[model samples]
Target: MRPRFITLEGVDGAGKSTHLGFIRATLLTLGIDACFTREPGGTRLGERLRELLLAVETEVSLETETLLMFAARQQHLAEVIRPALVAGRWVVSDRFTDATFAYQGGGRGVANARIAVLEDWVQQGLQPDLTLLFDVPTEVAAQRMAATRELDRFEREEGDFHRRVRAAYLARAADNPRFYVLDSTRSIADIQSDIAQRLAQLAEQP
Candidate 1:
């Protein structure tokens, strides 16, 4: 099997973090050398930016946030993701460019065209081979997020913001062939089962 980049995306508390291990184990069982990483913190410089970005006390402009995101992404791609793929390992990332489209583009009202230009400049032709999008109702996601340790800047946004983010995510999924949208309202076992089936199908592909 060719080394492939996979990303798991969703609104916060949609349960993507919970299933990452299962996804990795399943990939390993399929004989893939899978390695897991996350956006905004995959590299050293990225990790520092991650703290600044997520801090509730920090206020950032939309353009500043978007630029910082791509800056971290450039470092992540060069220092972590690309090297892992080059070493014949499958890369599984928690979030990627799609989150930018949703968070900055939808939630923050940044223009999509602006993000597109940055994406082209930073990522060039690189894109995830598969993207698993965990979908959930806004209320459900909010309820789950309420129990988390602390709300980050993005997580502290109001209901209207989250709705826009979800819409943006779905819109992007609709336009992309590599995305698999999973309804997170289902049981975890059922979700994993479906993911397993998808993995099997992917494994059979050339």
Candidate 2:
């Protein structure tokens, strides 16, 4: 049996990481063998790439950034994700390709065609079986992020940029049945319960 590839996506401070932990616990309670990971840092090489990508001092062009992200993702998939999924362990991720589309294409105003080309090349044929997108208004997400620690490079982008990113995520979810959009403004427990229901529905599928 192939492992289910589940991915969680959201803007910064949308509580994606919190939900990830909740979902992991839920899966364990249900007796599912699962592995939790995140892109661009799931392996050693990917971790290094992540640091370079997120570091405040490191400056790179949008094209360069997008390519580097994919480079890290390729390594992550080859080293951790694909292997675990092949081994029949559920692979849950913090983020995936949609992130690139949101950050680079939407926020940075990169051409969608360029991003699609790179995505096709890097991902090859692999795609998540389920993608849960935690959606929140740009202002709300910004407020939440501000309440946290100092912002990273990506998180420091202008408000308009984040708005574009959120819009892009919604557009993608609107077009893809595999994508599930949840309101992150709701209480954490409510979000977790809704996620549990979604997971149960997935488990019921043939």
Candidate closest to the true structure, highest lDDT = 1
lDDT of 1 by residue, 1-206 (tens): 77889899999889999998899899989988688899988989999999999999998888999999999999999999999989988899999999999999999999999999999999988999999999998899999999875789889999999999999999999999999999999999999999999988887888
Q: Could you estimate the TM-score for every candidate?
A: 0.98, 0.97
Each candidate's lDDT (Cα)?
0.93, 0.88
Candidate 2 residue pairs in clash (backbone atoms < 3 Å): none
Best by TM-score: 1
- Cα deviation at 8, candidate 2, in Å, is 0.7
Alpha-carbon RMSD, each predicted model: 0.8, 1.1
- Give the clash total for candidate 1: 0
Question: What is candidate 2's lDDT per residue for 1-206, written digit by digit as tens?
Answer: 34799999988878898776779878877678788899768999989999999898999988899889999999999999989987889899889999999889889989999989988887788889999999999899889889987998999988999999999999999999999999999999899999999987776676
Which ten-residue region of model 2 has the weakest summed lDDT? 24-33
